[model samples]
Target: MTNNGNKYLAGAVSFAVFAGVVGPAAAVSWTPPGVTMGVPLGAAFAPGIYVSNLTHYGDGPDKSITADVPAFTWSTGWKVFGASYSAVVIPEVLKVQNKVTSKDFAGIFSPLLIPVSLSWNLGQGFFVSVGEGIYFPFDSDVSFTTSGQTSGWAAETRVAFSYLKDGWIVSANTIYGVTTADDIGRRQPNYFNVDWTVARTFGKWQVGAVGYGAWDLEETVTNAAVGKGHIVGVGGMVGYDFGGSKLLLELTRAVEQGGATNYSRNDTHVWARLTFPIWKPAEPGEEHTALK
Candidate 1:
């Protein structure tokens, strides 16, 4: 879950925007920025939940193990301005299954992370969303490694944006480690990312191709010590509609970053979710005719 791409802030913004305008159209799936076309607005809203399992293999001297129950409940709805908003709560664990052998031994812990975001649908195929939330380091075991010792607690700030058109979508997202928990005395600087996708829909099916990457910025060193920093990833998703609800299945590979010694090869992960309508469809306005 420490991968900047998996950060709560960026993911939440992506989901909110997709659910608001995309409707039940599938194929392009959650493929951001490159798959927008003929999408309507303000058609859905209801509280739902999402669960995902992620496995990351870093390329370096250290081995990482991130196995946990990462689930979030969301309450989302549309705005009168053709915008959308959501609130989420997620708790998960991170562990170092295999280290470099020469490092001091400590333990792993689970933390509670929450994110809230609001996106504005800027009519005629343009949209944007911005949000701020806290990652409370409630886990006693999550820590900082320095000078043969371990520490705890890290706080972060997040921001994300996306633009849409008939056949393309462009997006950029970033997170900043602005503050630290009491156990960890200092906070790092910034971590950022940019991703783009292009796609088209055919009836109930949509197809898209995508590529994205992340990098460290400012005082932040991209977590090089524990084996992190810079990434290039490419992937795609296929979607289908089951009438009342829609389903999306996705695949992605991490091309670089996540280790200190060796760069990991095409590490893969999958995502799936179900979305339902929260409200009844609005009635179409009647056509006006002059009395003959």
Candidate 2:
């Protein structure tokens, strides 16, 4: 099989075995920031843990796949050059199963690292951010030659915009990712992904609708046309904030997909974030104070 075909087959088998694990197509964007629009206050930092269970029912030539992922993330922010900068690190483990091939794959995958991000509050409830990250495979067990895996090293750039005011929030995030060519001289095409959310907050609870779409930006090494690999998803989200922590639940259905793409027809996600102040600026009208 050509590298492009192998990549697609790997995705198909991934969905068939692990029920749609968090692969390249799904991991391009960061989690939604919810209703917050401005930079973090008082030296914000947090260590968060997340667990997601996903099951995918394939269309076309693929079968069912289910997988569970447990992740640990550390996020922190600081002010630099009058703008807010943040960093995040996430490590995850994947446990997956393929019913069609009667095969099971379980191991750690590449960790996601976003070491640099800058944000600005543009006033009038508008905010913007830009960042870059990389997916570097450290686990030898995770390989493109594997039934449920694809390309090794990949890099991504992300941009986001949000408006928040009067208990209403709207945001959009977009990412562009490029994968390195494999040993076989086969390369997966570059891809672009975008996600949008609109939500309203009532007291400590927020409800909203979310949608996402992804498409290839360039032709495959085999000359397959760009845009032939695409997927669209729509879903609802509900969340609650408890001062120092937040919990969110989302359920989405894949409304459209191309045969070459590896995506589930449906999926559910849950996220929990816990934050605490590690440093704080001096109070208004106060003299210079060290972080406390």
Best by TM-score: 2
Least accurate stretch of 10 residues (summed lDDT) in model 2? Answer: 283-292
- Tell me model 1's lDDT, rounded to 2 decimals: 0.36
lDDT of 1 by residue, 30-54 (tens): 1121111111111112333333232
Candidate 2, residues 1-292: lDDT per residue as tens digits? 1232222233321211122323222211212211121112212122222222222222233323232332222333346665566665545444444344555555545566878766666777677777788877443333332343444566878787777667767777777777764433434556777777788889888888876777766533223322346667676777677664455555555676663444444433332333333333343222111111
Error of 1 at 160 (Å): 3.4
TM-score of each: 0.55, 0.68
Please report the candidate that would top lDDT against the real structure: 2
Clashing pairs in 1: 27-206, 33-169, 34-169, 34-197, 34-198, 34-199, 59-262, 59-263, 59-264, 60-262
User: How big is the positional error of residue 199 in model 1, measured in Å on the Cα after superposition?
Assistant: 3.8
